[model samples]
Target: MTATGAGQAYGIEALNVWCGLARLTAADLFAGRGLDPERLDNLMMSERSIGLPIEDPVTNAVNAARPLIEALPPEERARIELVVTSTESGVDYSKSLTSYVHKYLGLNRHCRLIEVKQACFGATAAVQTAVGYLASGISPGAKALVIATDVAVVDEKAEYSEPAAGHGAAAMLLSDRPRVLAMDLGAFGNYSYETLDSARPSPRFDIADVDRSLFAYLDCLKNAYADYAARVTDVDFTRDFDHLVMHTPFAGLVKAGHRKMMREQGVTGPRIDEDFARRVAPSLIYPGAVGNLCSGSVYLALASLLDSGVVTAPSRVGLFSYGSGCSSEFFSGIVDEQSAATVAEQGIGKRLEARARITFDEYLAVLEHNLECLVPVENRTVDPAEWEPLLDRVGDRPEILTFTGVKDYHRQYAWR
Candidate 1:
């Protein structure tokens, strides 16, 4: 189970991260929204969330990816063999988001483009797929670009759903040299089953049996961890991993899953609480502030932890990724020797700090604008020139990519 002799050639080279710039504090969202204030207060407690405009999903992918792509020496960028976009928030049905992203980024025309959809687990699949491709002997010096981006748009009017909804994106550059965590393909732990934990029959919003979804997530964690544990006996997970990063739809579920996982693994008592705080709490900071990014959530947690500069090479990080409807995996990777250099280059912290806090009213307005984009462009008699600027101003952050209104059935996006 150790990476030795496991042939871990395709490790992450670089990771770029970004989140929705518009902020919504949970307390402000429920202050006077025609609800039982006390109950809403108890539900969200004192948490804040962020949301992206409907168009921002693709924009997020591009904005997040541009940095890593630009940072690459031109020769490396030219040799990119594959570009894969993983998301639950795709702008077009007929054409993959990779098509737009590939063109916008001006990648080599010969590169292959693909899009993956499997709720939040899509990005993991993309990374694995890239690993498989490299294992198959791709062109020399070729690399793969895997981008996980998503926006959580729920029924803003529904109190239970709004608190868990948020948006963000992360882009990873996979190559032979490891700058970030070197993935161990051989030691993956996975669990999958058919269940109606969460689904979206229509494109507008997701409907979830929260209680069922939470149970499934924890159960999957237990099963996947057991599978992985059977192969690697040298380290007890609680005592080994420097950090445990879990997909966070909201913070409480992960905390609950942590306790359940410990009990299932036959570990107990005060040490469990202490281990959770030391190994798991650091990964939650960004997710706690940003809400859920669906496909981007798990990786975002890892990126946030590494961006802190506290974790270094040779440290093991346990990661659990869950995609509702529902697939989950428990995997682990070792931080690389060059992690400090990678973290120094990543702009995640700066982007997050630059984010603007907006009123609950502004959040609602952005929600309404996103809902409007859901309507088919063909159905509306709209002129792009008139509405483009208005939509571009949704999040109001300068220099980032934004999605403008559709023009003659083609979705429009640009850096503004």
Candidate 2:
């Protein structure tokens, strides 16, 4: 009963996705570490299951949201006033992806749907907006579902890109009363002029370029810490929060930022380092292992943290969301003890552990797959076990189910 009362507020529930990591069998990553040929075959099969267009990050996100929304109770589902989709991958220039999701999910025709575009910070912005909507008294039993999903496909030939490319999605149900925690919207962080260059072009379609050097990233963290320190005078930075959730593009980057912030602020304590290691560090390992999922990356990390029991009710949680247009936001929330146990039991850990790992070669094959085709042929076979029949059609109309194997060296799809 810490501040938000005994009823549920905003909370995240189930998450589902098709990622590069989900393509391999358990033996691939855990047992053989991607060496077994059988595991590789399975990986190839998985890549061929969804079809070429499904290989992209945005498609994975959009597909994942469909079932999640469908699973909600009618009453709860109807209460959703908005559907916010955060993504960097978009094929449409004019229409918002949220509109597509809205139509696909068969949501209330009058509900507001929007796509937020602040790089990785988009979902966080959506979450903040949901909180405001709840506070504003728009509808009784009002709720908002924020979905973040992405597929990070990196070019193997790229020098700077990590081999850990992946794809996944997460869904959060936001409301008032008896939930994870009451969100505390605090002051926003400022961006530095030098940080603007972080988003440079790369051979890989998924990864973004970091503008600052290691030192510069640290310097930005120091600036962020200073900004936070100036606003909140009462809470102890180290002990107040159970864990600090960070925007982790990579594991080492977050650790480096934390060390720099602690050093510059002259705040040295065992609790700080302990918190950084035991809580913060582990929270980010999912991203390191799975590659960056763009907008979905941070929320995926948050789900991992909650799953591991590193975060609990009544504990304060600090969240740092950074988007490489170089904007960042620092906020905190207090977990509600009532629903903490329930929400934490949502089984995100099992889902993460259940992912399949593909080899570097298979990943390359997946990346090379072509998506812009109207017809399918027998030569389109990539993997027999994984491919689904596709329908060929004219214009933007839904095509007929034709060829059934992998095309363009990628997976093929079949409609139900």
Candidate 3:
């Protein structure tokens, strides 16, 4: 059965998203170690060596969500109904990182909080859940906060998954008023097996064959889209959306999926007009630069379009989210006016432009540093001159302190 809903009063209002590199480009990695640049150069030229930037997923999630929380009027902040975080970057196996986020961001103490795990589609699920909550009249006039974050770590030993991976984060604030668009959820399907561990390592921790994973993904895409088409009605797939925002694990896959969808739906000629190119032009393919952030990838792209002004209120946006092991969903929504303006004015575009590009060697250094042993101590002092106040920490953690850092990890902050 298909799930469908329409509402002019509920939609996404504003999104504060951020992308960054904790270190440098991957090309610099070989240079820093005095390794042969010839091999690296050849790799880059062949399209196999393009490396995405590395950022701490936790930090990115926190950073992206901070602005949204801070921008909320004080009265609204106190009434937040939910905080949903989607990630593949949880710090510990047992802990729900959302709890830490709630504590750090000073969200309402009464908030209903949870984490979502469905590969890259987790946040989309959260968005759908928020809609259901609103539809059920559970949180009247209250807002739902959704955040997606991940650091794509390429498995060096894997040949196929390397080129397409990256890292990044995105955040969205959904409320009942000032609705931007109507959301309709379509066919959902999942393919599972006891032995499929291609996208991730097995519990015993062995890398499954990359080719097997790729083939499975292709098959899953075909199946999911076919199901979605058969199920959706009253919307012409070809003419309705000016854009199709597919969950991109890599740049090429998105194109493949779009082509497949068009071919299957029998769309052609003027019907396929310039809107296709214009809509897809702003496609957010951060994974090529940020790696695969799992749940955050698709939403990050949506935020990118909103932040860049490619999408405005009343625009119909098509979103396709996929999760490996494996589930897929196709959904569409319209943008709201005030939300669009708030997003445009929030300076997200500026923040993305302000990021510093690092060399491969530098990125490796940061990763190594992060992985390396550090002196453990409590009550670390942050340089007030370096850190800026991103959020007001509430509750019983030692009094909060502010410090400066590169807005996206160029600098470091320690709570004093």
Candidate 4:
């Protein structure tokens, strides 16, 4: 009895996503720090990194969601009753990122706009919250928009964690008649606690005690998986689930977490390695390419799996989500029949290919500009004549929300 045919009423309908990566290689990241190449290779196991120049969390969210929102039938798009954005990279303290997303998407004015924050777990929380809202029947037949967006800022000086830093965002639509995947509402488990293993006390910097954070991640995975195992009673991570997706802070940690989870389910040694190589490792393609997406990592992994064509109707896909400071959840969702068909039609690969690559020097300049933007200066205004030509250098991608500049102590953005 797998969680395959549970007849879920609410689940993901479509996933519209975008990743803004400036083309700097992992070698470039290490070279910037004057670090050992071999060590960086082992830690990150990633080939490329992405950089964002004028894109903030808001623009990232808009770029991620706009395509899908526009593809929605006029009626389906109009029925959107809620917008939830989850990010630790939020630009505004009082105003939720949803305000920008709502306005840019031209969503109905009556939609509820809220943001969720709990380190990397915020997006998963937002997704679960959306599911709950749908279940509440407050707005039956209306859909919910949930976006997990973040830009992992790189501090080249920080050798231990900088290589894996990446910037990306994912937007998902949830409703009862999901065209993507139908979640098993009953097969869910969650765990949370307080720990300072990782944090971004400063908006631009991420401080992590690497060892402690990995330990906390493993602990959260253990507790959440235990809770899920107890509830399902018949799940075999190697057999019952077609794919296993986890929040990838980096590639190595995900491999370690997969081994640990397999060992606990009474599978170990060669068998654990085998299952991970086949079932789990495939999900890492996107992360392995794009690097860490902060809150967007897990869903990005899911999108990678969907693109792989291995998941099909009735296949159970297990997901383990972790957020440092710290929380975790273990859940499984069944693939709907239309999921693979929908995924095949998606433009994720095309978008990734279309991103403009920047040189190592260019990447550094972008970061420096972001750092400069951080120091608030009162009454600082940009003359459009002076900045527009510079902003145009970032390329003109259609429908992409570009961070124009700041005026009156407010950050400004416009669509490209």
- Alpha-carbon RMSD to native, per candidate: 3.1, 8.2, 7.3, 2.6
Which of the two, 1 or 2, has more TM-score? Answer: 1
lDDT of 2 by residue, 1-416 (tens): 12322343444434443332244322333232334444332221112111233344334555556555666788878888878888665434455657655655678876888777666667877877777777676586777878775544344333333333345656666776525556654533444433553442322343344445344455655566557656665545555667777776656567767766666557676755775777586566556545556666666666556555555457667777777665566767765444335445544444445443445344344456532222223345434234232212111222222223444433344432
Residues 360-387 of candidate 3 have per-residue lDDT tens digits of: 5434534443331121222333333321
What are the Cα lDDT values of the candidates? 0.74, 0.54, 0.57, 0.77
Q: List residue ranges in candidate 1 displaced over 4 A.
A: 1-8, 32-54, 233-235, 379-398
Model 4: per-residue lDDT, tens digit, 116-188?
9998898888888888888777788989999988776557655768778767788999999877777877677
Ranking by TM-score: 4, 1, 3, 2
Runs in model 4 deviating more than 4 A are 2-8, 372-396
Residue 379 CA displacement from its true place in model 2, Å? 17
Ranking by lDDT: 4, 1, 3, 2
Ten-residue segment with the worst summed lDDT in candidate 1? Answer: 379-388
Q: What lDDT score goes with residue 137 in model 3?
A: 83
Residue 89 lDDT in candidate 4: 79
Q: What's the count of clashing pairs in each model shown?
A: 0, 17, 26, 3
